[model samples]
Target chain A: MAYALMIHPTDNVAVVTEAVRPGEDVLYEDANGGQVCLKAAGDVPVYHKIALRDIAPGEQVLKYGKTIGVATAPIAKGEHVHCHNIESPERKELI
Target chain B: MEFYGYRRSDGRVGIRNHVLILPASICASDTAEMIARQVNGAVSFHNQVGCSQVPSDMQYALDMMAGLAANPNVYGTIVVAAGCETCQCGMVMDAIAARTNKPLHGLIIQKEGGTIRLIEKAVRLAREMAAEASTLRREKFPVSELILGTECGGSDPTSGIAANPVIGKVSDALVADGGTVILSETTEFIGAESILADRAKDEHVRRRILEIVERYEQHFIRNGENVRLGNPTPGNKEGGLSTLEEKSLGCIHKGGESVIQAVYDYAKPIPTDVKGLVIMDTPGNDASSIAGMLAGGAQIVVFSSGRGTPLGSPIAPVIKITGNDATFRMMEDNIDFNAAPVITEQKKPAQLGEALYKMVLDCCDGKLSKAEALGFTETAVMRACNYV
Candidate 1:
C-alpha cells in the first residue's frame, strides 16, 4: 500500500498517509504516470506533508493543488512540512 | 429518492415531531425547560439571548425563537416569557404565526401572578401540545423536500481530509437530486472567502459571499479584535492544523463542489425553489450554529468533527460523524458514524457518502443517533460579543 498520497500531478508535496521513519523510500507516479522514488528525510507524522523534491527558502508550498503557505527555510526532499519551517503568508494576513 | 418524515400543516416535512417549550427571554428559559421536563414528547433549549441586546440583535433573537417554533421538525410549541424582557413573547408568537399554522400557546410569568402559577400553566399547555404531537405519524417525502445542514466543530487535520470531504460527497448528491443544503459558520469562512466566491452561481451571489465576509470582519475590527487570535483553536493546533487559512480551506471542503445558489441571513428559511448549496451567516459556536440552521427549516443536520463533540439540537436530529479514528474509538458514545475509513482504508468519498445518506434515511425513519439516544440536545442564539 502507498504510504503517501499525491493528490494531484501539479503538487510538489505529498501527504503522509501514515507515519514514516527517516530513510524509508516511498514510490509515487508523477503527472505523466512516471514512477518517482522519494526518501524520507526525517521521521514524518501522519497527515503531515512530505517534500517530494528540494524546495528553496521563501518558496510557496502547495496542498490540495493550492498555495497553502510559503517555506520559511530551505526544505530538502522527504523532509516533514509543518509550521516550524513554513509560514502561511495569505492565511496570516487574513487573521 | 424519498425518506419517511412527518408532514406538517405548512406543507413542510419533518424528520422528528417534537412539542417545543420555548422561552422568549433568558429569564423564562428555566420555566420552559421545566415545562418540557414535566411533559412527555416535549423539548427545550437553553436560551442565551432574549433580552439585554441592541434592538437589531434583539430582533435576531426573536427571529430565531419564532423560527424555532415554526421549524418543520416541531409539531407544536409553548412559548414562555418574563413580562419585562425587551423581546416580548407576543412578538415571537406573531412571527411564528406568520410562518406556520402549527398549534401554539404563549404565556407570561408576571401576567400569571408568579413563577409557580406560570409553571403550572406552562406545564398544562405543554402536556396538551405533547399529547397532540405524539399522534403524528411519519410519511414518505420526496428528495426535494429535504433541507440539509452541514457543520464542523473541534476540527483537526482529518476534518478537512476525511469527515468534511465525506460530507461534501453527500452534499453533492443531495444537491444533484434537487434538495437544499445550508452551509453554516461564517466566522470559519475567514481567509477562504475568495474560494467560496469562485463557486457563486452569479455575480450577485459572488458579491454577497464577499459582502458577508467583509461584514463579519468589520464586526471584529469595530471591536479592536482579530478573529485570527482565536482560530486554529487550541484543539485545532493540537490536531496538527498550523494556520487559520489552513483550517478555513478544510472547513469549506464540506460544501463539496456545488455552485452556491444564494447567501442567507441567520434564521431565514430558504426559498423552496433554490436547489443547491446555500450559506447562512452564523457564529462558529457549534450549538448556536446548529440552532441557526434548524431555525432556517433544515429537517436534519450532518455535523462532522475531528476532535469530537456531542452537540445536538433540541428540534432537529443531528447525525454526528468523526474523521479522527482515535477520537471515534475514544468518544464512541458521542460520535454516530465513522468516516475515518476514508483515510485509513483509502475509501472513496462517494462510498462513505452513500453510507451516510443511508444512515440519514434511517434517522429520518425514527432511528436515534448516538447524540439523540444520549439526549444531548443543546442550543443557543448568536450574539455579537464585541465589548460595546
Candidate 2:
C-alpha cells in the first residue's frame, strides 16, 4: 500500500510523494493513530495534491499548514486539487 | 565536507579564481572590457551605471563596484574610470580598501589622456593583477563558509510544488550545517509578507519585514502604477500562474522554515556571522537580484524555474533547477538539475533536496555547472533611474 503524506496535520490535502496507481491501496494515518484506507483514483504524480477531506465552495484550502487558495466548488476526498477547483484571492477575476 | 577554495588574505573563501577589471562609470566600460580582452583570466561586466545624478544612487554604484572587488571570488581587481563620474576611481578604490586589502590597481581614462592610452594602461595593470591572481592556490574550507543565495524565476504551477520547496529543504539543510542562505526578491514577497514576518525572530525583525514590503509597493506608487496591478508576469501566466499572491506564496518557500535574521538594502554586504536565512531587499529582475546577492557575499546561487531560464552570474556559479517536466525536457542544456522528478515522478522534496545539497558540494569542489561550462558570465547592478 502506498499513500501521499501531509507534512502538517492542519493541511487540507496530502501531497502525492509517490505515484499512486488506480486500484492500489492507499493508507493514511491521522494524528491519533487512526488509519484510513482508500484506493487510488488514478496515477497521481509526485508533488500533486490528493484531497483528505471534502471541501466546499469558498473554503480555504490548506497545504503545508498554510492557506494556498479558496475552493471554488465541492471536492471529494482523494480528488486531485489544483487550479480547476481553487482560485487565488489576488486574481479572482481569472476564476 | 570541504571544498578547495581560494582563501583570501581577509579570511574569506572564494570558489572562483579570477582577475576583475571593474569600470567605475559607463564611459570606462569599453576600456575595461578591452583590457580584460587583452589579458587571460580577466573578466569584466559591461556596466551602464556609476555616472549618475543622485548621490544615493552614486553611492549604490560605488558600493556595488567595491563589493564585487572585495568578493572572495576575485583574487585582485583593476578599476577603470573616466575620472569625471560621480563614483570616481579614487572613491571606488577607497571603498574596496575599506572592505578588503586585496591587490587593487586603478586606471583613469581622462587622466591617462585618451581611449587608446587608457586601454593600454588598464591592460598593463590588468595583466599584472591577472598574473598576481594566478599565483593564489585553492585551500580546504568547510561547507559552513558557503553563503548560498536562493531565487526563483520563470515560475509555473510546478514551481511551488517541486523546485521551490526542494530548494527550501536544501536551505534548511544548509542552515542546519551552519551555512548562510539569502532569500531575496522583495516584489515576490508582497502577498506573503505576513507569513514571512511571522517567522521573524522578534517583533522588530517582523516589523522590518513589513516595512520592506511597504517600501517596494511605494516604489510602484511613486511611478504612478497601481500597487496590485498584477505582477506574476506574462511568462508566469503562460506557465499557469495566475496571480501575484499565488506566486508570492510559492516564492516564500525558498526561505525554508528558518528564522528570518536580518534585512538588507540592494548590494549591501550581509553580516557574515548571521546564520540561518536572511532576506535582501532586491527587485524581481533575475539578473539584478542575483547581482545583489553576489554583492552581498553569496558565493553560489541556486536558481529555480518552472518555465526555465539560462541566466548566470559573472562572479558566482548559478545552478539552474526546474520543476516542470516539459520545461526541463525543452531546455535540457540550460537547466543543471531536474527537480521535475518531484512533480512528474515520485521523488520527495527532502530526497531531491539532499541531491541538491550534494550538487552544491560538488559545485563547491570545482564541478562545472551548466552555466560555468557554457561560459555564461552575466552581471548587472540595479540602477535607480532608467537608461535612455
Candidate 3:
C-alpha cells in the first residue's frame, strides 16, 4: 500500500520512491476495481524501479514514458530492476 | 511577475548589493583582501594572474577584472594594483568607467609607497564606496530583466533524466517571458553540437557552435589527449552513463528548446536585448565556467548536479538542484531542490520547473540559497602557465 509510484503510463514498472523491504505488500490499481498485491522480491531504495509485469529478454524497459534500456533476461514482477538485468545500450557497446 | 532588486547606473538590475575590492594582479591580491576585511560590505578574490607574457592572456585577466566590477551585483569597486602588472589599474578603471558611470576608485601598491600605505588608501576608499552603495535601494523589476545561467556538474545517470530536463523547462519558461538564458561548457556539447546547430536561428550561429566544439577538441589534441577517450569520466560510468555521446545528449537538454541566438567569448558581457538562449565558450570546469558566466553579467545561476556539490560565488547566488534521490538524501545539506521526484514519483518536469522559477524570484528578492547559507563562495580565475 506504500512506497509505490507510477512513473509513466507506458512504463511496465513503477519506481520505489522510498526503501521497501522484501515481502512487503505493494497494492496497485488493477483493471477490475481491485487492488493487485505485489510482494517485493528484494529491498529497493528510492529512485529504483520494480517490475510491474513479467518482462522478457530484449523488451524495452520504459520509464518517464521513454525506453530507458532493454531487459537482458526474464525478470519476475516485483523484482528490482537495475544493472543486473536492465543495461543501457551505450554501456553494452562500451563493453 | 517582478522582484525587488538594485538598479544599476547602466540600466542593469542586480539581485544582491555588494562593494567589490578587485585585485589588478597576484601582487595586489593580499592588499585587496586587507581592504575587504577593513570594509564591512567589500569582497575580493585571490587573483593569481596579471603580470604575464602574451597580450591575449593579459587582456583576458584585465577584461575579467573590469567585468567583475561592471557586474550589476557590485554598486561600486576599488581597483588595487602593483603599478607594473600587465593588467594596469588605470586600464581596469577605464574599462569599468566605459561600462558604467558607477563609483570606481584605484590604488597602486608601488606608486603608493608600500603595502601598508596601499592598504590604508584602499580601506579608506572602500569604506566611502560601501557607504555610497548603502544609500541605493531596491526597486521592483520585471522577470525579463534577469539573465540566468544554466550549468551542470558531477553528472550521474539521473542528471539526464530529471534535473537537466527540469532546467530545460525553466529555460523555456524564462525565454517565453522575454528573459535571456546562457548555456556554456563547450566540451559537454561535443557529441550533441549538430543537434543544437540544427536549432540555431541561422547558418552563422549553427556553424559557430560546431566551430567552438571543434576548437575545444583541438585544445585537447594540443594537450596530447583524445577527447573521446577522456570523457564520460569514471564516476559517470559508475552511475550508468556509458559514452561521451550519451553524456553530451543529456547535457544539451539544459539549454531548452529556444533557438540559439549567439555565442560569445569567455567573460565578455552579453549584449543587452539579446533575449533568448545564448551560448558562451567556456571550459567544462564548474568553478571556472560559473565564474565566466558571473563575470558576463548573470545575476543568478541555476546549477544542476547528480553528485551534489556545494559551489557558490561571492557575488551571484547559486541554486543547487539534484536528480538522484539517494544523492539528495546523502547530501541534503548541499542541494537546494530535489528533481528525483520527476523520476521516482512521475512528477512532471514542468512542476519542478515552475518551482525552480519561483525560487529564482525569491532568490532575487533576497532569499539565501543553500550554497549561500553554507558560505560556499567559491571562485576560480582561468590562467595560462608561463616560464620566465
Evaluate model 3: give its lDDT: 0.80
Which one is best on DockQ?
1
Off by over 4 Å in 3: A1-95, B228-230, B383-388
Candidate 1 local lDDT, residue B8: 90
- Per-residue lDDT tens digits of candidate 1, residues B292-368? 88888888999998899988888877998888898999998999889999888879888999999888878878898
Candidate 2 clashing pairs?
none
- DockQ for candidate 2, C-alpha atoms: 0.13
Residue-wise C-alpha lDDT for candidate 2, range A1-95, written one tens digit per residue: 77665656787777665567766776766656677776666655545667788889899887657676788889777776666777665422110
Tens digit of per-residue lDDT, candidate 3, span A1-95: 45565545667876555667888877655445456678988876554577889999999776545555678989889988776787544322100
**Higher-TM-score candidate among 1 and 2?**
1
Largest lDDT belongs to which candidate?
1
Overall lDDT per candidate, in order of appearance: 0.84, 0.81, 0.80
As a whole number from 0 to 100, the lDDT of residue B254 in candidate 2 is: 86
Error of 1 at B255 (Å): 1.7
DockQ for candidate 3: 0.08
